[model samples]
Target: MKIFVDRDKCQNHGLCAISAPASFQLDTDGELQYQESFDDEHIDDIEDAIDSCPLQAILLHPDAA
Candidate 1:
């Protein structure tokens, strides 16, 4: 799956990180960073992150590949 975050809509909250640390993280600067792609095994975690995002900035897309 592919993950996209609308930076303009994101508040840099760490809930995504809390839900899926392997896919999302808050850098030392407290900025949100995330992987653009992940293996199928990570879908559940990524979904949790998407649902947990308070700003609803997280988006999930089917992998084009």
Candidate 2:
């Protein structure tokens, strides 16, 4: 899957990081950083991250069928 974050809408809340540290992180500046694509094994973590994002900035896009 592909992950996207609306940087303009992110507030650096770190919920995404908490939910999926392997895929999402808060940088030294406390900005959100994440992998653009992740393995299927990480889908559940990514989903949790999407749900945990307080600002709703995280988005997931499955590959085109």
Candidate 3:
């Protein structure tokens, strides 16, 4: 699937990083960084990351799933 983090809506809370380390991470500067696409094996982790976002910034689109 495709992962889209709305930069304008994200708060760099790092919840996504906690939920899905494989796809989301906080850079050295403490900024949020993520993969635009992920494999099927990571769907559950990705979904958890989406749910953990307090700002609801993570979006999962099936365009590439």
Candidate 4:
């Protein structure tokens, strides 16, 4: 899957990071950063991250296509 975050909407709350540490993180500048693509095995964690984002900045795409 592919993950996308609306940088403009993200408040750097780190909820996604807390929900999916392996896929999401906060940069040194306290900005949200994440993997664009990851193994399907992580779908559950990714979903959790998406759901846990208070700002609703996270978007999950089944495929880049």
Which residue runs of candidate 2 sit more than 4 Å off their true CA positions?
Answer: none
Report model 2's TM-score to 2 decimal places.
0.89
lDDT per residue as tens, model 4, 1-65? 68989988999999899989989999999988899988888889889999998989999877846
Residue-level lDDT for 14 in candidate 2:
92
lDDT of 1 by residue, 1-65 (tens): 58999999999989999999999999999999999988889889999999999999999877786
* Candidate 2 lDDT tens digits, 1-65: 68989989999999988989889988899887889989889889889999988889999877677
What lDDT does each candidate get?
A: 0.93, 0.89, 0.92, 0.90
Question: How do the predictions measure up, each by TM-score?
Answer: 0.92, 0.89, 0.92, 0.89
What lDDT score is found at residue 58 in candidate 1? 98
Report the C-alpha displacement of residue 14, candidate 4, in angstroms. 0.3
Candidate achieving higher lDDT, 2 or 4:
4
lDDT score, residue 15, model 2? 91
lDDT of 3 by residue, 1-65 (tens): 58999999998999999999999999999999898878899999998999999999999876842
Ranking by lDDT: 1, 3, 4, 2
The better candidate by lDDT, 1 or 2, is 1
Worst 10 residues of 1 by lDDT: 56-65
**Model 1: C-alpha RMSD to truth?**
1.1
List runs of model 1 lying over 4 Å from the truth.
Answer: none
